[model samples]
Target: MRIRKKIWNNDAEPIIAIMVVLMVLGTINVFSSSFVLGTTDYENPYHFLRRHVLVMLAGLVLFFAFRKINYRRWRPLQGPLMLAVIGATFLSLVGVLVIGTEVNGAKRWLFGAQPAELAKLVSLMLAASTLSARIKRGKANSLFNVCNMKYGLIVVMAVLIELEPDMGTAAIVLGVPVIMAVVAGMSFKYVLGLGGFLALLILILVNVQPYRMARLKVWFDPWADAQGMGYQTVQSLSTIGSGGFWGMGLGEGVSKYEYLPEAHTDFAFAIFSQEHGYMGAFLVFLLLALLVLFCVRIANRAPDEFGQMLATGIMVLIAGQAIANIMMVGGLLPVVGVPLPFISYGGSSLMVSMVAMGMLLNICDHGRNAGGEFPKGEAKVTKSKDNKVHLKLVK
Candidate 1:
């Protein structure tokens, strides 16, 4: 593998700036939102703030570490890395069921971290490596061959996460890989069939679980049971509405004083809106949009199919979760335990997001350095006389 002399360049500057701004804003909002909860629960007003800062520091370390390392280094270790992540995820998911900490009647956390969070990055990596190899070998021409072990691993992980009863995260774990596969050139018919199956599965899951069904109802009308099942949504809407245009001015919002649940994690954006109002909320959205745009740009410019797939997967992962969290908080969608990326106060989530961004930045750097020639085994698509798509390796 060739190493670049300069790690910092204009190509990576915008993303770095975005990540820094989000992290700083996240630190401030986390403190503002969690001070009361920290005081009441831990007898220390700064308890959550302290933990948030510590996690931020750890995440920064990972961000820089991944940024400095070559993204292609992982290709050689894909098999071992995939197997290790699968084993760890399996154990963590099962162990959480047996001995995991239960919060809000859900056992999604084991040893103070969510294994489902880590699974997202690993699954994407596995998909990129598997799909790139298939493209290089001309094996991606068939849907059956393309949906290989990597897809199986993704489905198994999704099932385990669903068993953790975290449907939102499960959807992400399952959905993002399929998106990468589509980018890798899976047939639209296959995608449509998979979509129907997932929709049916979601319907079944919701109907089978009374709580999910109730959430769907509350999503339609939170005021129906404002003090019972719809309490969080009601409070969230009120909190956001109170912000008006200019907001209540940071630290002055009243919702975080026990009115809204998970104020610093799942509903952190609501608290942000309450404090900074419409303008602040818009700014955050714009930043997230820019981040996604830049990642897509990186994917388009990546030197090889593998790098392109990796960047595309990361882009989808971040954008999807951010959209879900914001919509859920605004009552536009049914509330799920999805957190705002980078801005939510969760160690596992923040760490994974930062590391993913680091990998993305590394890909951007590679794109900048690769002038014309690409790495060996670069996959190119060709169409035969019979109108069949084929991959030609440009070694």
Candidate 2:
């Protein structure tokens, strides 16, 4: 008997649903958190909100555009993409130092784009491609072989970003690739050595910068300098505390009234917590957890080692950035300029995140249709005597 099979199972629907919900929540939170700053800085309460909505719309466009492309196509193009990303990152980072706009004492923007954000995504792609190639060649286990052009370029990118004085982003750029390498089967001893080197490097970086040291000190005791260096942390904790079990109600947050800084960007979660309470905070956590789980599933089902590594890198990027931002806000870590993935009000961050999700969804669709193994008694394909292709279910 003839049978039929669905060409596309839409395994990515859950991820898309979660993404849309996060975007909607983000839109509301951005407006709520930024109106006060918008009014003060631009003399219009809707200034930031309007800009944010435009960016979100553009992000959605890119998301759909990327989703339609084949994930495997990126593998062949990795070389050119790697060079382009490295060049753009180098120029953008240096150009920012020369002609980029300065916000709060750091120059991290050039031509309305944050190259560091784009670098993160591209670097992961390059890492995945390079590592997968190494694994295929039987050289993945060699530390010397693994430390190739791709790894070096990524390190350079991280250094340039750190020079932007954005240590938080630099850390993500540096850390995620190592995680990918480990997943690619790097030896444990090398992993430990690399970890020690990274930890020592972080220590030097933190100790070399007075501001970083201050942030570290503030992390330890915000109340010691509550009115000065530690003001934001103290206010963040207070804002979250005030939310109690249920938030203060949307738009009723008091911290955005100049008590807490960067309310819509790096510390957006605090404002969100202040307005929505513990339940709201938990909801965001749940969504992120779900997103991470979905990413793992996609990685496991990816069509090839390349796709698997790519998916793994994307998962690490989202989870790592979200954890860093939330921890910074909660005083579990020193303040870092990392933004919450979909929830932060930054165009570059949102755009990059959306594009990454798009690629992930593409991987999910590809895996479902082409990669996964078929179960027994499911539909099978055969050719008839007339040379017509037919699908039949095993009895």
Candidate 3:
């Protein structure tokens, strides 16, 4: 007990506390929302709950493993790490097309792994590593080249995910890197070109699929086709609306019983809003806000450009997914089927999210010792007498 207390006191308290709270609440809500589905499909009311608990246990192991590692150690091997992530993700994405399990008409999972979920984090890492390396080398002229190369891979990953029909994860995998590049001081002209290109791609993508077009139509007016493409959104909104202020009380929501699709996965927020009510929803948002704040605080205190970029990327990924989930459930945006981070009942997403959180905590710990003053002048890397590149952060 003393040892555990010491560990907690020595780490980032707010992040730890908030993560625990979210996990506990999420576990409870998963049981509440998924019991019916679990029973009907698997003949066990506790199937999802049991699976979620096991997944959460594995996630906890990953969390602690990442927390114990020094964040800077990754800097030395960023290139190889980036390549490995890209290669692994690409294979998984390709493999899914060949032999993957198709869930709800989307081939997204392979051998119990969701590569799209992994893409979000790995792409973020590659973005940070690439941008930071270029910046440290002071390759201002080659900024566009780096952007093209790194973002080109990101685009490929996004395309693969989109082919899986999982546009929500694709958007996040693509969006976070663009945000990081802009913040990393990429050329304005290049950024503009990138933005225009992305807009064109989105336009083309929306038109390529009939269902996507239908989604857009529903986004514009769900009431027009309340029983077709808009069914899920309308159902989700009705669930939230029925919750009132304090909710119908925990374990008492009526929407989860074959009324709302994806009550424990993509639309978990709807179930949460229904059971917890407006106040409960607000508390969930509060927790997410605190999580984002803690990440920003860690980024601000990061020791170098890489740490800052990595931390910021993780922050965007988590907060973006959460916001997208909330908006989709609240009828403020088209249903993109993004899950609420740490709250949704999925092994792959939960594991990936916990890993990101662990990385954030690691950054927080290292940032505490990082000096307050920002490094002035560009960092330079030079080959020493031993032919090894030595990095020097100039003040």
Candidate 4:
């Protein structure tokens, strides 16, 4: 009874449904990928599946609880949230510098308790809040007058993220606000100019870092040095290709048996493609597309600019990670080390992704609430007393 209430109590059914589908797919696929990885440790190969269940439970709890609270409550948390995340990202970067943990020759952590991920969500919200306030004050349409107040704050946050050397995430974080600014009615000329400048900055960043250049070179053709920086991409392609149409069959993949590096983390998509085959890979992509479409729909129906921006930021967050992960796996882009959102085996990424989904659901809930109220013991709804009806007759 209690479980039913928790699961069915939301007005955000469409958003919740998308998350549920992803969680289910992720859980099944991870089992398919990790059973063999865990077989040596436990008699049952479903060890990771058990852990996945626990993680999903924790995530669902957060989902329901977060749904009850208004997201506006996060407004006051913006400054402190940014500070805390920046501190954590810096600590992780410096921690890697001091006692760095190396995986596949990269300093990114396997246990990314790093605040960078959390910062992505906070930074998005902060940017949304900052920009939304301007729009509400009717300054959004004003040329040379918008984005002046909190622009400093946004830049400082971006610089701190870039300082961590997490260019992929920093790029997405910065890009989102720019999108929000444009959507909020910032002038097109300004957006075009800002985008050009951002591109130049990225070029400089790539020029300055030898490894970044190497990754890009390998992205163009990993075969150039298959045994060097090109190694992972080559392995990823081989693994993905080996899967063919139906895949070699789950737990039967040759790659996760140690052929592919980062098999359980950042490059887990390669493992997935190997086990599930093209059909499986296509299904995963389809679900992701559906998830993206649903999030955008929710954003379109959002009651206010804050809600719209929040929904949009979260959608971009998921879509960005998906595109980056897929491109890396497919050998179309450098391995920027962004994990596959729901499908990757992770702690911080999993929970935070769930939180972002929760926020998305919260946005939908408000839309549904405004639309109608559920009648007791019935799924259909009627107008609530608290809300004034605004109707337009058919013209």
What TM-score, over all chains together, does every model reach? 0.89, 0.89, 0.88, 0.80
- Give lDDT tens digits, candidate 4, residues 78-173: 556545755665465456544555554545452545545666776677767776666556666444433454555556555655665677877776
Worst 10 residues of 2 by lDDT: 370-379
TM-score of 1: 0.89
What is the per-residue lDDT of model 3 for residues 145-206, given as tens digits with 9 covering 90 to 100? 34556667888999999998887789899999888877777778887887898899888988
How well does candidate 3 score on lDDT at residue 287?
96
Q: Runs in model 3 with CA error above 4 Å?
A: 1-11, 75-83, 137-146, 187-190, 369-395
What tens digits encode model 1's per-residue C-alpha lDDT throughout 105-178? 88989889999998898778877888777766666645763467767877888888898789999999988887
| Number of colliding residue pairs in each model | 0, 2, 0, 0
Q: What is the C-alpha RMSD of each candidate to the true structure, in Å?
A: 4.7, 6.4, 5.8, 6.7
1 or 3: which has the higher lDDT? 1
lDDT by residue (tens digit), candidate 2, 234-338:
999999999999999999999999989999998999999999999999999999999999899888766566878899999999999999889988989888889
Q: After superposition, how far is residue 101 of candidate 4 from its true place, in Å?
A: 5.9
- CA lDDT of each candidate? 0.85, 0.85, 0.83, 0.72
How many backbone collisions does model 4 have?
A: 0
